[model samples]
Target chain A: MAVKAVKRIDLSLAPLVENTRRVIKGLKLHTICDSGNCPNMHECYGSSTATFMIMGNVCTRDCRFCSVKNGKPQEPDKTEPGRVAEAVVKLNLKHVVITSVTRDDQDDKGVFNFVETIREIRKRSPGTVIEVLVPDFGGIEELIETLVRARPDIIGHNLETIARLYYLLKPDSSYFRSLSVLHMVKEFNPDICTKSGIMVGLGENEDDVIEVMRDIKEIKCDIFTIGQYLRPTGEQFEVKRHVDEDEFQRYEVVAGSMKYAYVIAGTFVRSSYRAGEYYQKYQESRKG
Target chain B: MKEIILPELGEDIKEATVSFWHHKEGDEVKAEEDIVEFYTDKANFSVKAQASGILKAISVKEGEKASVGQVIGEIEER
Candidate 1:
């Protein structure tokens, strides 16, 4: 039986895209936008915002859905922080996002890189808000503290999928460890916003999604994002089914009923896409 | 006369600044040749000449912003 392919609607080309693409390349910087092939690249680049992927593009782990290359990563570029700072200044962004590939091979799992990047961004773009989306360090206290001490405005660790599917989808990562990391963020500094995101359409039910939401919320997570899991590459797991807009809406409704300040559920919503806009939106909502 | 309008850039960008002109009016330009470069917040783009012609009239000046669908210059049939 032949199944009709469902096409994903993509952003139309905008005049701002070329310039943003060139700038990211010129700065010798990497964005999760390009690395992950994020659906919101056009929207993010056009708006002059990007989630900068620091350290390097190669990851130590081969998460099933992630498109980032996995293998032997080169030595961490010492000058990377300076260039990231320069890119933040060049983009003139009010809120800057910095993320990285997992470097479990390293002694400290590349935690210091985040520390340096935050310091450099602060030094160069003094007014920019810094948000760091990180990986779980097996709940290591010292590693998590190193990141928290950086004092980024928001700390994000993505659960990526539900607890039941973790062994198959993200075998290398643990569901509970990620929750503990988010919990540690609030425990370390309640003022700094803690956030986590999960993906749907990987054969999980609504109950699993809600269960993850409740777990994260119990850890005092502030921002929760739920998006459909689009297989990043042909070699990755095929998309089981396209979770329609109505399901995403339902997820949003359920998540909003909970305590999170921001609950974004959409097909194209990623942890870092248009994150600055969400941050500002939350602040405005608070004021009201 | 053929008009050269800006192509779609990205969803968030409405206008872009003409950063520089690689070919000015009266310069013989080849089709598909990069004739001008534009700048936005993210990067620079060198727009290719749509048709081989004598660069005719440039309406958008250097250091000026051009909105999407706005004609920036004219190319005369050579």
Candidate 2:
């Protein structure tokens, strides 16, 4: 029998999808969902949820697997913080995920934008939850501290792939540096949830994936998500294999056993997928 | 006469509720202009006029449900 395949849901005709696109366009905001060509774009947009990309769409580093544009970026927009907050209110998002392209050229590596955006959201929408999927900030402790000081509800940094393949996939980034980014967040403030994710199907074996999980566990990271890597375009890295549902289930079982605060493993799962629900669950767990 | 049929909304969406009509019956509508908005459990979608005409009838009232391809209204083409 053939293995069951997980596929992206088709939502092109959804009216709210068009409306959300219009809002983002009108507000002049960029979203990782659009910039990265995320598979869940239409579904997320239809439901009025989007991962806002700050700083600018251009990135400083070229990652082989990423779809975001890599080039010298323009100066960060001063009005972006307020506009993102306004978009949160307009979309009526209870939880919003903010991410940005890697800006290695900047002195602070765009930490200021992250901090200001968090402050703006808190000022405008006190009750709304903020989650930031951040770049490594070059693993600088003070830059990390500046963002931690802003107090986003959750901070996520994707490991992107296993350690051995890290150099091949993310040539400009360091695997150890990415690990320290998650480790430092816990060190700075354990109260704020720390998250990291990895992509599979880029020619890694199960043992390699397990070793990465153990590494994450060793750092005491709180949340873990794993998903199959779908090739975005011919220009980017090609998928080594199509991981089936059974493998995803086995990974889920393995991750669950590792004592993460929460773990989601599947073909369709992304680090920021249904993040609001996970935050709610994390909050509930805290109460209990 | 052009029948205003609800277009296929793609994947698992079977029906929608008429949320609002941008124009009332007997109002002149331009081709490609949105005339009605329908909402499902997931999203609110706007339907556009196929051609410039006068809206002659509304088979589905506001807050009423409609199925895919159902004629919810009519337009008398100029």
Query: TM per model?
Result: 0.77, 0.77
**Model 2, docking class:** incorrect
Of the candidates shown, which would achieve the greatest TM-score relative to the real structure?
2
Of candidate 2 chain A, the 10-residue stretch with the lowest lDDT total is: A1-10
Question: At residue A225, what lDDT does model 1 achieve?
Answer: 88
User: How well is each residue in B1-78 modelled by candidate 2, as lDDT tens digits?
Assistant: 988877544334467799889899999998888788876542356667877899999999999999976989999999
lDDT of all predictions: 0.80, 0.83
Candidate 1 stretches with Cα past 4 Å from truth are A1-13, B1-78
Best by DockQ: 1
What RMSD, rounded to one decimal, does every model reach? Answer: 10.0, 10.1
> What's the i-RMS of each model?
11.5, 12.1
What lDDT tens digits, residue by residue, belong to model 2 across residues A79-151?
Answer: 9999999999899899999999999999999999999999999999999989999999999999999999999
